[model samples]
Target chain A: MSRYVLRRVVESAVTLILATIVVFAGIRALPGDPARTLAGEESDPATLAAIRATYGLDEPLPVQYLRYVQKAATGDLGRSPRTGLPVAESIGHALPVTLQLAVFAIAIAVLMGIGTGVVAAVRRRRPAEWGANAIALLGLSVPNFWFGQMAILALAIAYPLLPASGFVSVFEDPVESFRHLLMPATVLGTGLAAIIMRQTRSAMLDALTADYVRTARAKGLSSAQVVLGHALRNSLIVVITVVGLQLGALISGAVVTEQLFVLPGFGKLTIDAVFTRDYPMIQGVVLVTATAYIVINLVVDLLYSVIDPRIRVGGPAL
Target chain B: MSLLEVQDLTVRFRTEEGPVLAVDEASFSVATREVVALVGESGCGKSVTALALTDLLPRNASVAGAIQLNGVRPSPRARGRDIAYIFQEPMTSLNPVLTVGRQIGEVLKRHQGASSRARIIELLELVGIPLPGRRIGEYPHQLSGGMRQRVMIAMAVACRPKLLVADEPTTALDVTVQAGILDVLRNLRDEIGTALLLITHDLGVVADIADRVVVMYAGRVIEQAGVHRLFAHPTHPYTRGLLDAVPTPGRPVLKEIPGRVPVMRATSDACTFADRCWRVTEQCRSVRPVLEPGPAGHPARCWHPLGGKE
Candidate 1:
């Protein structure tokens, strides 16, 4: 298992390198001159050139890439073109907000999804099943952005129940921060919850019909015990996979929701960077997001072995 | 008195097409200390009948008639520890994520509440599993197929039930492992005196283990008799067809019961085996023969049973 983990870590490092190259290349290819944008239209050619040189844009593409790699290795992400502050510091400031939203969204999704799915699967042909399925359909079909706007309008504009715009750090005021974070998290999480609920219901349905479940029943176990004890454990592997996939989307969605709520998170930062053509900020966010995605997947893979011993840690023993 | 008496048991699944009969008024019994083999091809409803005894049939399935276990009236909500079931695939029958000891321990805990860890280990050891003390902590995947099957048997017999219903326990095993599993079951029966209902398609397995044989054909019993008598003078055309299909050492290539078991499109008022039986006649197609004695203690369900003038 240790060897398997070591091998996976090596593979993950290679994947990370490839991802970095793709993001770096793709950002560089986009039609925009960060130096010109930073200098503004009124600036003279010499001032633009100085700005370009400062940002290492005057170097050849290969030389710039090599510098980016070297700096990235040393945790130096340069400075935001718009703010002239270090990009790493900006990211650090924004990351916690994104993390906070992602965690809350995921928690909500899992709790509601698994709960609804188990109930629907057990009830099976009942009206509750139909209702659960319908809710899942609604969740899958409705766009997150649309939902976010709706939530803001309903809770912020219509009812004035929640703070419509701006974010407060939980460390500053836990109660106020929760109140501000609640609506955005719910908006982002509901869609994922519906998906999880639907997937979990289907998985539970399949697991309930498995031969082992029948064996559990034949052992004189109560229906609840059979469903909860035997069926749920087997169905959890699929649920965990869905949860892992949604974590990336949740982090991405936090950006949109953060913007709607006026939260100074990675999403808003990235959007601002895109508008101002802040190459350093954009590149830094992309690298961090990509790394998070890869790391989460690795964690989930390790978890699979823990959840189900059947999954061999390493390749089959040759 | 019989340990289990399944009288006129019929199970029908409500499909979108119609109500498809899976088990057609199948009647059989198991006496204490007796192993009755419910022998049939796949889809012959042997497993359905076994499941119906414990009300373990699926929700779509509608089962009718009486299933009495040791004079106790059967109910859908009745505890099933009195009649345990061992399924065909052991790897699947035992929860893959759980330890073998815990799986067996669950049955004990459920039925016999507060059972000690030592007792669980003893049950594992009883099933001939090695390292019972240490192995109990290991998950199902750590165990081999034969070992898994033994764990299943251990789980089934944990409650010391009156009847153990083994549905093709050795069908998923290699020939050598198959004998070992059968031997374990036979020994368990001898030790515990728990009546066994062995369901399988293998005639050789039945011949080797069963004291009585109940042959099923397309959801109905075709022939039933003492193991020796049935083997000596196979009656129903379906039973003879099945026996002839079994490969014998130094004999000609075995004949198969050509074509699959008919998918019951409509209610089976006509003979279920008419399409496949070589000796099928107009009368065989017109009237579905009920199980009746062809000789003392031997029942055959056929219009013109073989080796009979009745």
Candidate 2:
């Protein structure tokens, strides 16, 4: 098991390096030059040269990349030209907000998704299942931005129950933080919740019909026990896989949601970095995002072994 | 009184195609510790009948008739407490995600509301799972087909259910592994006096473990007799066709009962096997023959039943 983890860590390292290269090349490929973007309009020629030299834009791409990697290894991510703040510090500030939102989103998605999915499957062909299905369809079909607006208008504008768009630190006040992030988190989580529901419902349907389920039923377990203990647990392996893959979507959704809510998160930081072409901030954010993906996938792999003993025998999918 | 009595049991599924009859007035009983085999071809309603015994059929199914244990209907509480089921696919019959111990423990827990680790180990040992201590920690996928079936048997017998309804327990196993599972089930019956309802298509399996055999054709109980008597006398034409289809040492080529079972329409209108029977008579087509004793005093639902000579 440790060997499997060690191997994954090595693989993650390789992927991170590849991601850095892609991010560097991708940013460089953009029409606007970092030197030009950093050196403002009406700047003299000497100023441009000085900016280029200072940022190592004058160096060969490989040399610059190696320098970037070296500094990055030593916990230096350079300063953003836009904010003139350390890239790492900017990300540090934004990371917590997005992390909290992500945690909230995941919690909401799993509870809503699995809960409804079990209900639909157990009450299959009934009115409850139909209602759940209709809700899932609507959730999947509706646009997030539009949903966000409607939610803000209804909850914030019409009723004035919540602050329309803002951010609050959970460490400061947990309940207030929940109230603040609830709208954006739900809007972001809606798509994932719908997806998990669809997957869980189908998986659960299959599980409910499985031979094991029959054995469970014949054991005289209540309908709830049979569905939850026997069927739902079996279906969770599929649900876990879906949650792992859909996390990328959640991250992307955060990009849109955080911006709409005007919360100072990695999403807003990323968008602003792209619009203004702040190369350091962009690289730092992408690197952290890539690292997060790699780590979460590794965690997902570990979770598979926990949920399914079969995976332990085969040592997972390499 | 019999340990189990299933009388006039009927099951139909409401599907998009239509209301399909899966089991039709199927009646049988298993006396205390008796091993009764319900044998038939695929789609002949054997599995459905077994599921109906425990109210285990799918939501689309509507079941009618009586399933009584010990002279009273087996209530919902009778499941796993008085009766337990082992399905055909041992590969799938045991939950893949759970340890063998946990699966078996669940039965004890459901009925008794408390289960000890020691009792679980004992059940595993009773089913002949090697290294019950270690096997308890392992999941279904880790075990071989035979071992998984043993685990299923252990779970079924955890509460010492009066009857263990095993639906084709050996069908998914290898030829070599099949005997071991059958032996485990037989041991279950012999050791605990647990009545066994063995559902299968294999006559060889019927010959192996069953004391009496009930033959089904197109959702109807076409024949029922002592296993040896049924195999020896082989009264009904369909029963003869089935027995004759089995190869003997002297036979040059194996005989096969041709034609698939009909997509039944109005079950009682005629003999369900008439279309597939070589000796099918006009009477066989015009009316349904209830199960009645033939000239040999052997019960078979047929217009013409063979005499006692094979």
Best by DockQ: 2
Q: What's the CA error at residue A160 for candidate 2, in Å?
A: 1.6
- Give the runs in model 1 whose Cα sits over 4 Å from its true position: A60-67, A314-318, B75-80, B253-260, B265-271, B274-288
Q: Interface Cα RMSD for candidate 1? A: 2.5
| Model 1 clash number | 0
- Compared with the true structure, what per-residue lDDT tens digits does model 1 show for residues A229-303? 999988998999988998877877787788777888889888888888888888999999999999998888888
Query: Native contact fraction of candidate 2?
Result: 0.87
Query: On a 0 to 1 TM-score scale, where does candidate 1 land against the true structure?
Result: 0.92
Docking quality of model 1: it rates as medium
Model 1, position A32, has a per-residue lDDT of 75
* DockQ (0 to 1) for model 2: 0.69
How accurately is candidate 1 docked according to DockQ?
A: 0.58
Error of 2 at A83 (Å): 2.1
